[model samples]
Target chain A: MFPKMDALGMAGAVPRAPQQERSRVTRARLLEATVECLVEQGWSGTTTTLVATRAGVSRGAQLHHYPTKAALVMAAVAHLADRRATEIRAEAQALPTGPDRLDRVVDMLAAAFTGPLFVAALEVWVAARTDAELRGALVPLEARVGREMHRLTAELLGADERRPGVREAVQATLDLLRGLGVANLLTDDSARRATLLAAWKQQLKGIVNS
Target chain B: MFPKMDALGMAGAVPRAPQQERSRVTRARLLEATVECLVEQGWSGTTTTLVATRAGVSRGAQLHHYPTKAALVMAAVAHLADRRATEIRAEAQALPTGPDRLDRVVDMLAAAFTGPLFVAALEVWVAARTDAELRGALVPLEARVGREMHRLTAELLGADERRPGVREAVQATLDLLRGLGVANLLTDDSARRATLLAAWKQQLKGIVNS
Candidate 1:
């Protein structure tokens, strides 16, 4: 059993080390479950109770950490995106550099967008379109994530933003890859996407190298 | 008052000309209203009763034509996309067909995706990711619309798909424009998007022209 909160009814009051570690594991599970629920059930179908059950944490514990569904979902969004950024960097480390570096980096970024995390993020993006409260939470988080991705892409390609068109070329690459991700959602658009990526990689070389 | 359906409970049973015209107008109103509702309320918040009220049609009439929510929404998705394609073609007619044709075409496509129709389609797309029935209705319709757009884009750019990379170049252009549309949904991404489009236009000219 988890330890009780202090008189202030706050979990942030320096709980014992063992309890703190347990709490971290529980929260991570909750966030991961929230993402899975979003991917499986979408924004409307996902609820706090359902997420709690899926996460294997008690409803009370879920509420204690994130009182509202918005808080829980937003936290998951942030967590998922942060994890994805780290994953992209880690994956990039294994890639080879040289003539094929740009192609490999583009493929890695495209793969990042085609997975479950992107699907979860997309559900939030569509839901945020109509919900102002959710939109408010999502906007800043996405901006930060997007900036990090753009910076990472520029670094990976070794392209200098100061060299005219380099910044836009990098951005175009992200946008094109994301669009391919969207296209892949309903159907297996892999064949068309492969062709497009090959073409983009070639044009990307000229822009970044020249 | 509107005419009643035939004994077969079908409106396509050779109704009177005036009644048929009225039905056409009513159907158009309903489809337009559905798109608006999807954009304003999202997929979960959109309902048959709400769409009927918004369209100024009786719920009975709405059901008589499209018995299920999925049917109504799918029709709207197809209708919205069709209208957008038509608008794009009509708008493109006024665009000059000279040196700046490719830039103008790219700009036009980007504008198409940033509008309410695209937002409504996006709402359905996310909803369809988890809803099998909705996905079933959407895939073919989107493919048809996508093909039309691609063909029109190729013609407008005077790009020959017979060329090795021209097809992928055009597809990439669409994907990039669409990704820009997604980026615009949550924030004002015009400045960054403008720069990216400029860079793409230049690269596109080489791929498509060569």
Candidate 2:
């Protein structure tokens, strides 16, 4: 009886029937292609044609998924951010709360920023600055990341946003992380990365203790 | 004798060949134009042609001065860095050694990173990552900034580079400053800047005391 022709069975039987699955595949392809193009040609050099060619899709098909380059870039940035957030969150959760939390955060941040996906996303951000439309799309993502940092810091420091030095610590930490991101992109020095991470841990410990 | 050779015969004398003052006017004009274009069109948008147009100079004139877009951007970065180094040095010299030195260093670093010129230079740096040629040219400038930072931190802490945590502190502080530069660019929140600066100072103090 062919497994009772239900939506699940039919969907499984016909691989191309489900719109959601097809959409997911298209989105994945688009993101993978975006990253590839970004790493190969950088943000300024990556074009729709290049992404389409890399993705093995028609330009029209690519457009159907991401109507504009800005849109595609934004999607890529979000994709990267989402993955990083998950990774950081997991690391933060695994660490014991006090000083260890700070270490975990710094290590996680350094690793995340230097990771290939994040590097590609950062390229998009650089590209987005020259693009007003893309910048507009990126603002919310920036805010979201900031908010996450604020939340994480608040949790780690046992202070609210209104606490005397909580805001400063959070901001400084974020800045440190951002600078390290740039450093990683510029230099391939693991020792430098380790030194930076250690310093961040030490600094965060000071902030927490003080 | 014809009234002493027409009153000392000084009438036709070329006015002491006016010491051809090496005017930095052209350089200043280029830097100003670069900033304007960067702010208007971003790093990628500020091409040599666009910068020349903005500076009201011919392409030949621009090339004669800068030669390459990377050269122009790097010149702007160096100009900004020089100004910052001068400002920090002045502030550091004004302070009596002890804790005041550290305070002034932190203050200067915070202020410098958050300033407009630094922000513009950062935008150029983001663009530099994509252009290997520009990145190569700019790395030394970045290293110089880092070296200056390490020197300042060492002096402030009265510690050598080989000191237990001096290198880490220096690296971390620089990373913090870099992150702050990006944060300031992304948002127009003065309050956040002040908070971040205070936190940075406190953190530095803790490290020194520790």
Candidate 3:
């Protein structure tokens, strides 16, 4: 049980180690639940209560950490970005310097756009467009995610990213992959996605090798 | 003044022509208003009463045509598709059949993605992900729009429609442009968009010319 804030409300209060650990665990659970709700139910169905229920945390605890739903979702977005950055690095380190690595890297980029991570982020992006308070929180977080993704993308491509205009071309490729991800939302057409991926991989080779 | 439905609600009731035309005009206005609202206010701010007022139609008239907001928005998606199809044809004809044509065509495609049409559609798409009835109405309309856009894109490019990989390449270009459009929503960075366009144009030339 949390004591009254007045007990710990001093200007420079320091919580005990056990309390800090409990708070961290509760926050992580809430963020993960938010992602789950977004992917399965989208923005309209994702609420603070639902997130708290799914995380098995009391509403009081949820509100204590994130007073507003926007705060909770914004924190979740930051959490997702951190996970994606770690993912990109892991994928890059796992890949070798050869044609097979290129194929694998391209696949990695494709998955990043179309997989659960992108879907979860997309729900927030859509909701933010209409919600002013959310947009205020999301814009800075989005920029950081974009920068992290760009760096990881370059690392994945290795020497291919060094040439002039290569960055632009690769950026375009990622953008298109995202578009394809959106398209897939309604149609679920794997064949077209595959065809586009093959064509883009070839295009990337031309841009980088040139 | 319209009478209650029970008065003329028999199994096979016939509405007169002038009334039908008036209804048509009212529906068109409402659809157009929905797009304007989406671009300016996004989904959260859009509602039936606001659309009816914006369209200058009576609330009764609005309810008579589309009983639910989902129905109204779904119809708007179809309306948007028709407008895009018309825009593509007009742009293709306005463009000359030469080198400059390719440049203009690419620019036109880029605008189609980043312009009001795409943004309006995006609002509906985002809203639909969480709304089942809306999703059911949206999927078919989206497919029809996708097909119409593809045909016009082939014509705009002035190329054979039967090529093996050409469709994939062109689709990828459109998709990438759309992704750029989404990115622009937050950052509003025209310079980055232009650079991506130039890079994508080169990539397309390689894909199609091959």
Tell me, by lDDT, which candidate is best. 1
Model 3, A87-133: lDDT tens digits are 67766787788776767788888777877778888878877876788
Q: Please give, for residues B41-97, the per-residue lDDT of candidate 2 as tens digits.
A: 777677899888887777887898899877888887787666566666666777777
Per-prediction DockQ comes to 0.70, 0.45, 0.50
- lDDT for B202 in candidate 3 is 72
Reference-based lDDT, residue A139, model 1? 93
What C-alpha lDDT values do all the predictions have? Answer: 0.85, 0.69, 0.78
Q: Please, what are the lDDT tens digits per residue for candidate 1 over residues A44-145?
A: 889999999999999999999988888998899888777777677777888888899889888888888898888888888888878899999989888888
**Model number with the top TM-score:** 1
What TM-score goes with each of the models?
0.91, 0.79, 0.88
For residues A69-145, could you state the per-residue lDDT of candidate 2 as single tens digits? 88887787676566566656665777787556667766766676667776786676655656777777788887886
Taking chain B only, the TM-score of every model is: 0.90, 0.75, 0.86
Interface RMSD of each: 0.9, 2.4, 1.5
The regions of model 3 sitting more than 4 angstroms off are A1-16, A159-162, B1-20
lDDT of 1 by residue, B1-210 (tens): 677754223335554689776787788878888988988888888999999999999998898887888888889888777767767777788998787988998888888888888888888888888899889989988899899889988988889999898998888888987888899998888888887788788888988876
* Candidate maximizing DockQ: 1
Q: Considering summed lDDT, which 10 consecutive residues are worst modelled in model 1 chain B?
A: B6-15
Model 2, A84: alpha-carbon shift in Å? 2.3
